[model samples]
Target chain A: MSEKGLLIVLSGPSGVGKGTVRQKMVESKLFEFQYSVSMTTRKPRPGEVDGEDYYFTTKDKFKEAIANGKMLEHAQYVDNFYGTPLTPVKKMLAEGHDVLLEIEVNGAMKVREKMPDGVFIFLTPPDLMELKDRITKRGTDAAAVIEKRMAQAKVEIMMMENYDYAVVNDKVENAVNRIKDIVSSEHVRVPRVIDNYRKMIKEN
Target chain B: MSEKGLLIVLSGPSGVGKGTVRQKMVESKLFEFQYSVSMTTRKPRPGEVDGEDYYFTTKDKFKEAIANGKMLEHAQYVDNFYGTPLTPVKKMLAEGHDVLLEIEVNGAMKVREKMPDGVFIFLTPPDLMELKDRITKRGTDAAAVIEKRMAQAKVEIMMMENYDYAVVNDKVENAVNRIKDIVSSEHVRVPRVIDNYRKMIKEN
Candidate 1:
């Protein structure tokens, strides 16, 4: 059987170390993982590459893509349209390269609707206090914003049941290894391997 | 949430190197895994421990256990009764130790009927030719018996579709590592971890 690449959605609440885990996974080179670059109307920050970080686009272009069904899943956050572009992800999967989409819970849920077979992984902090500490230490957001994010985090944690796997990001290295294991094991899933076996049996 | 250990069933046709892989897994000391010892009416061979190899039992006792619904699955092979004792498996699982059962396809299917939640894995040879070579090299069975076994292997390979995972035993080390990964990843399954996340969310 011709193996198809997996569409893996890595999502978690804010400050759950999803980014750190994903960064380590990429650095490890354990698997041929291609990030599904998201299209966003938000302007790029300093040191952010246009295509590498995100496909920064005009609001009108993003809306046009949405209207044409080019966006797999899109959401508006702080008046900015951010969504996964369908074309690249589809191309990557068709070429047998596993695609990783690191998005928010809402976007992940939306992706689930379009691609139900995708592996949805939710990365969680060891504890809520740990999550709070991580966010607080970042110092990027105001106290009120962090509080709002924490509230949102609780709601997102409740959505963990919707994922295929829930990995606790207790340590970045361990979390990355777990994700690697998950991906490796998923390749041998019965449905995916049955056709190959059938062909082999026929040949034999 | 309190974690319950997994019931993992490993099965394969003859000459698939299941024993070697299991040995490697045990030697790694990665997780607490206990074997679900089977009871057999056949006398133990040289250097075989009664409990460790198989729980040697009288034919009468084996029949009594089968009648009492104690055998999870049983079969008559070479005029001897071989079966898995259900009580010990349950006890190990209750004690939070992952249980491994290495049995034939029929026994694995029977176990599936009894414990539908168990993770069933089918180990396979790289190809039928490799399987034939391995079986031939063993120098135990006659040519006629080997032919019969090859036919049985075909049937068993077809049954691989019913398993949760199909791992090719091309290399013992790789197969062991893949099974290790599967066990590690299965723990983080969404349904298994959702309760823990719910409790944490509520507590916070």
Candidate 2:
């Protein structure tokens, strides 16, 4: 039996260094991970590549995909349809490439509903204070917006129980290594190996 | 919010190199692992040390421990009582040391029944041919005994589904590394980290 790849759903509160950790994981090339390119009806900003940053599409096309059940999980954000495409993820899994979907907790929950077997991981800062410090260091948001974000983070932290794994993003490299180890270990999980072993033993 | 150590129950079919992998892991010293020394009523062979190889004990004391629920799992082989003591495992876990229990599938199942949260891992050879080769090279068992073992191995292989993880013992070092990765990854599991995070977040 050929081994199938894992569908990993990674979610966290904003400013938890999810992007940085994910970037390090990608750069490490320790494991074959295919990032799920999302479909968005919103106009791409400068420097964003179509089908790379997102599957940029018109609102009509996005709605049509949604109607056809092509989207694994979808949400309308600020009047723009943002959703994960189902076809690409399935194709990648069939090719034995672990697919990572880095989305918000709400989107991840929706994906979990659609695919309950997927590994759901939550990334968090060392602590709430550290998280606030990171957000403050970004220097892009107003004080009021930062406060709103911190409030939202607290709510997300409360939902940590729903995840299968919680990785602390203390150091970018360390977090990347931990996630890599997790991905490697998951390949040898009993259910996956036993599926292949059953056939091998029967032949023997 | 202190992290408690994991009770890892490792089991495999015969000739899967569980002892060699366990030795490599212990020698690596990557993590604090306390091997669960079992109490046996059998006479110690050459080079065996008390408390290091086995806690050599009297049959009366072994039976008394079993009656008092001190034994995690016990089995009688060749009229000798072989059992794992639960007190030492509990003490080691309380001291924040990951405890590794290397036992047969039957004994591992008993440990699982007592401690359901413990991680149960199954080790296996690459294939039945490799397993037969390893058993043959041992030079201890006769052909008929080896054949009997192969039949027993088939029965044990069927129980792989009950394990949480399965590491294929192709190369001894590779299997040890995979098990180490699994141990490291399990430390960041959601339930364990969330318990710590809950306390940390509450203070913040």
Contacts from the true interface found in each model, as a fraction, amount to 0.92, 0.88
lDDT string for model 2 (B33-151, tens) is 88999999999999999999999999999999999999999999989999899999999988888999999999999999999879999998899899999999999999999999999
- TM-score of predicted structure 1: 0.95
lDDT: which candidate is best?
1
lDDT of 1 at A25: 85
Badly placed stretches (over 4 Å) of model 2 are none
Q: Report the Cα lDDT for residue A168, model 1.
A: 88
lDDT of 1 by residue, A46-152 (tens): 99999999999999999999999999999998899999999999999988889999988999999999999788999998999998999999989899999998999
Best candidate, TM-score:
2
Q: Which ranges of candidate 1 are over 4 A from the true structure?
A: A140-144
TM-score, prediction 2: 0.97
How far residue A113's Cα lies from its native spot in candidate 1, in Å, is 1.4
Alpha-carbon shift of residue B147 in model 1 (angstroms): 3.1
